[model samples]
Target chain A: MLTSGIILLEGGLLNPNPGLIFWTAISFFIVMLILSKFAWGPIVSMLEEREKGIQSAIDRAHSAKDEAEAILKKNKELLARADSEADRLIREGREYADKVRTELTEKAQQESQKMIAAAKDEIEQEKRRALDVLRNEVADMAVKGAEKIIRTALDAEKQKAVVDEMIRELAASRN
Target chain B: MRVKAISRILALVVPVLLSLNSHVFAVTAQAEAPVKESATAAAPAGPATVAAPEGVAPAEATATHEAEGAEKPGEVIMHHILDNKVYPIEPFGEIHLPEIAAKPFGIDISVTKHVVMVWLACAVLLVVGLTVGASFKSLSSKESPKGMANAIEALIDFIRTDVAKSNIGHGYEKFVPFLVTVFFFILICNLIGLIPYGATATGNINVTLTLALFTFVITQAAAFKAQGVKGYLQHLTAGTHWSLWIIMVPIEIIGQFTKPFALTIRLFANMTAGHIIIYSLIFIAFILKSYVVAMAVSVPFAIFIYLLELFVAFLQAFVFTMLSALFIGLATAHEGHDDHAVEGAHH
Candidate 1:
């Protein structure tokens, strides 16, 4: 057994001896087979699983980034729309206030004009009534004064006839 | 006028003639000595001795001699192929193992110089595997990868997903480590070969042949395991006439051996060819004896080839792994039911 072991050792695969090729082939086959059985399958699956995990992670990251970008875009759009809407509302409010102010100013001016015209009409009516009253009173006084004068004038006529007789006599005498 | 002319001519001619003659004699003497020495050297070395090939000038001979003295071409080639001086040579001489004799049913194991490199390579693989395995173990959560583990993990995953699982299919998980190790080991060996003074184990036909043979055996074993002995034999006669079995069987067996042989040659040739081209180009500089031209040409050319060699190293590794996987895939494929058809027809 020792001699055989020596022979095999002296002529082993480790050395550049004869049968080295054969032994190397056998040893390689055994090692490959054993490793395949014991270690390979698990290691490979683990590696594959890790790779798949990484790829999926990358895919997930890309999707998340896209989603974030989309959300950002949407937010920007909403902000722009809101800004436009606020601007429109501000313009509308200003126009509405301006319209109300113009209408109010016009209504106030119309009401003031109507009030002024009514006051002028009242003043004219009062003037006409005062004139009518003064005219009636003056006519009555004038009529009364005329009657008295006529009566007085009849008396004077009588006296005058008497005096005329006298004067006629006197003048006849002077002539 | 004649006397004045003759003196002027003499004054101009004397120095020019002397210098020209001196330059000519100097060049001639220098050229003659090497020829004379070679002639003397050749006389005693005998007629059967190969003359230095013609057109090689004395300058070329001297340059070649200097180059030979500095580093022989054979030594350079050998150093590129098989030199392994990673660590400084240790002086702690041989220590024979007493444990080999003590075992009752012993296995004799001895360490040699090459064996030591092989052992070192194995140790490196073991250390790397264990370290990676430990890192894998320490992964508490899968949220994000960290450190060297991430890089190693990525490589392992690529090999598994792309090479092994893709080819080997259902039972591919079993062969991943073997495939990965083979790929990495061959890749490292090829890369090391490209480095100055580093050995390429895979560049050796013997080493590659051994690896290929291993693949061949695994393929056969897998085929046999998948289908029984009878089924395995019937697989060779797949899709064939009954009378064609003799011709087909030998061809099939030969096909098996040829795959590994091709693997050996492909790797060996690819690795050796690039090195030879680079060495030959550099050798031109010495052959020409013109340092200016050599520096201008050879250095750039060699550098380009070296870069190409780096790419080849990875390519060869990938090709070997891919082909090996393909072979394994073919071998483990389902056995055809052609034998049943033949049997039914006979009945």
Candidate 2:
């Protein structure tokens, strides 16, 4: 056993068997052809299909993100416009209220001045009428007194004194 | 149904028994013949003639030629590793396969152990590949691959992206089928060797050489297709001066052949050496004929080597496919593709 072992070890280790080469080549070639026909096409196409599916999914996600961003921008613009509108309305209301207040104040002042001027004219007319009536009354009283003196046949000095007293009484009664 | 089952059982067991019977018969025949020779030598009482080296060579050669006659550890290892016209199942029997002798060239075309294993590997590849294909056909492409389809898909994707696409570069799709076939075939063959009573076809020099030859042919054909006849011839000069063509041309030619040669040797040696180491380690117990020796040294180391061999099996397949793709890439590369040409080799 040892002798045969040594002999085979020396001679047979590196020896190439031609039969194996022939069979291996034939078998390998057949396998390559068979597998190429049956196996590769389906696998590669399936992989490509999956890849396309993934790529389209990514594309959809991107478009959705863009749409969301656009909506956000639009909403922000709307909010800003509404805020400014509110501010504008408040500012206009305040200005209108101020204008109304000033207009009312000016109208009240003019109306009060007109009422004062009319009352002063009415007082002045009453004072002139009173003066005319008092003057007329004095003149009538003096005529009555002078007629009484002539009927009685009184002295000159005594008649002058009585007429003075009669004038003073008439003036007092008019006041 | 009972009868059908019984018949099925018989169909499986009969061949195994028949082969076992033949192997027992052959062993007795060999034992008796060797005894007769040694007895005649002893009867002659001629120690000098028995010692002659030339007298022994024929007997040894004849013993080797007889496939069932090898008994030594070295002989057993060689018989297992080399191609033979039988499938040996120790203690049972061996199946005597047919041998075809080519007329003019005188080549032996025997469906040996390696041949049978190659066929088995092919059958496996066919079933697995086709099963995956069928699943892909039946199931929707959007669905994730399941069961065998899932595993097959991973292997396919790996070889496509890492091996074929990375190495072959642009227009790599065309070569994916071939590369995928090569990778799976070699991987399955390597794994088949790990089975009991199975042979590693890739461990055989001829088998490795044949695989490398395929790569060689493909590479050269691709080069021819890309560079044309004139450009292909021009590459042999390697862009050297006319004065240096005499030196550079042969070197370039050798370089082309050397890549494949190296590939063949690399795979063959890696596979063969792992088995040899494991076998040698286990043989230590037999040599000492001691249980302690086996338990303490041989069995543990052998087991360790066997595990290492399993890893090596995958690695060698990967390296071979990687190198083949790199070589194909180098050959098919155009002017602008030169940058990635070296990248393939490095990996």
Candidate 3:
């Protein structure tokens, strides 16, 4: 164990090998040159690019959500206005219908009363004509009967002349 | 689900063990290997009974007199844990590496097994990195990666966010490439060691120290840039009184290096130590020369440590990267940052 440290320190494993060192340095330098330029450069930038893309996508989603909300609010307001407009039009139509019904009922009642009055006046004129015709016929019949009686009575002439003169005097006095 | 996981692990482990057992039997049949095995066979007997001073004498005695085909557990353990000039191949035995004795500035730049392993790790890093990069090119910003690409992305992502950004704070982008490369490279190297007959580059102190050296250099440079020359030099005094500058400056300088020193030792020791432990456990059976111990004690315990080593592989990689980023963060952090506020609140 004691000699082991001495062995390492003096001449064995710890002995300087310049050849190995030379190879290590050259190889390391070359490896460092190629790997740095090629491998790590592209990978890092790709990661960053992906991150930026994700951020922009999130921003777009937020903006689209806000726009959709605004459209929904505008649609609700238009729906409410249409509802109130429909209600007003229905009330105006009901009032116009009631006014037309009252005017038609009053005009029908006035036309029926004028027709009844015209019929009554025509009936009164017809009654007067019939009475006049009856009266003329009766007067003609009485005159015919009186003429027959005078012809019979004139056969007893003398006695009849004296009666006629008295009758004429009575008629003149009555007039 | 538990049975299925265990079966999955068994399915991975069984083939490896069978292949390794077959290779060991094949290696024993080779010509030159048996003699070398006999030469160093006496070493394992030393660890239990003999003193460290006499550890070398028995091996020398065994090779000369007792030329039996015996294996030294210590030598085998160290050989597996340490760097060498040969890469062991499966079924064929092994290949002798080319030793380039190029002493540039009087230091041998010879290629070793660990060097080949480092190259292997770099090759792996390149394939994975370039594949991921190409996939990213085809992928739209909206699309995510799949399968292996996805797994690799998770690791790279962890390093960037958790290791680099949380530690280094501002201006962390500049260091992400370096930190990620270090993490993946160290992780691959550590895991490679876990594979049967594979050498761990991170297990070598030389390799770990070199990585730490890079961290050290970056930390100082960042400190210099973030705090100007005046501030950088002033930091060496550690905000101490003028009377304590002599003691404080040396300490502060040493403190600056200690961070990387810790990182180097942490990774190297952890990787090397786990392999040492596993080999030591397996060698217990060979040391005792018994089948019952091999079955009941050695194999089971070794497997447990092997699993633990897998976790440590990822951990050490994370620790190294974390410390590196922390040092950089400490160097670049402003005076009135949350660090000072927390410190103030503590006081």
Write the residue-wise lDDT of candidate 2 on B115-147 in tens digits: 899999999999998888888888786579889
What is the total number of backbone clashes in candidate 3?
A: 0
Candidate 1 per-residue C-alpha lDDT over B1-347 given as tens digits, one digit per residue, 9 for 90 to 100:
24323433432342233334333433444555465455434322211112233455887876544332233232333333332212222233223322223322343333222333334444455555556566555554454456765665676677777877786677876567667777766676677666643555565555677778768877889889877798778777665797998898787677667777777766765766566556655755644447876888778878877887788788777777877776777677784444334323322
List lDDT for all candidates, in order.
0.58, 0.74, 0.73
State which candidate has the highest lDDT: 2
> Sort by lDDT, best first: what order?
2, 3, 1
User: What residue runs in model 3 are displaced by over 4 Å at the alpha carbon?
Assistant: A2-11, A47-175, B1-68, B336-347
The CAPRI class of candidate 3 is acceptable
TM-scores computed on chain B for all candidates: 0.67, 0.77, 0.80
Residue-pair clash count for candidate 1: 2
Worst 10 residues of 2 chain A by lDDT: A1-10
Per-model TM-score on C-alpha atoms:
0.52, 0.73, 0.66
Task: Estimate the TM-score for candidate 1.
Answer: 0.52
The RMSD of every model to the true structure, in order and in angstroms, is 19.4, 11.2, 12.5
Of 2 and 3, which scores higher on DockQ?
2
Per-residue lDDT tens digits for candidate 3, residues B1-347, read 24323434443343344334434533453455565565445333322221233455765764423322443334345556667776766455567789776677776677788998899898888898888878977888778789877888788778888999898999998888888889999999999899886899998988999999999999999999999999998888878799999998997788777778878877887787777767766766765558999999999989987898898889889888988898899888767334333323322
Q: TM-score for model 2?
A: 0.73
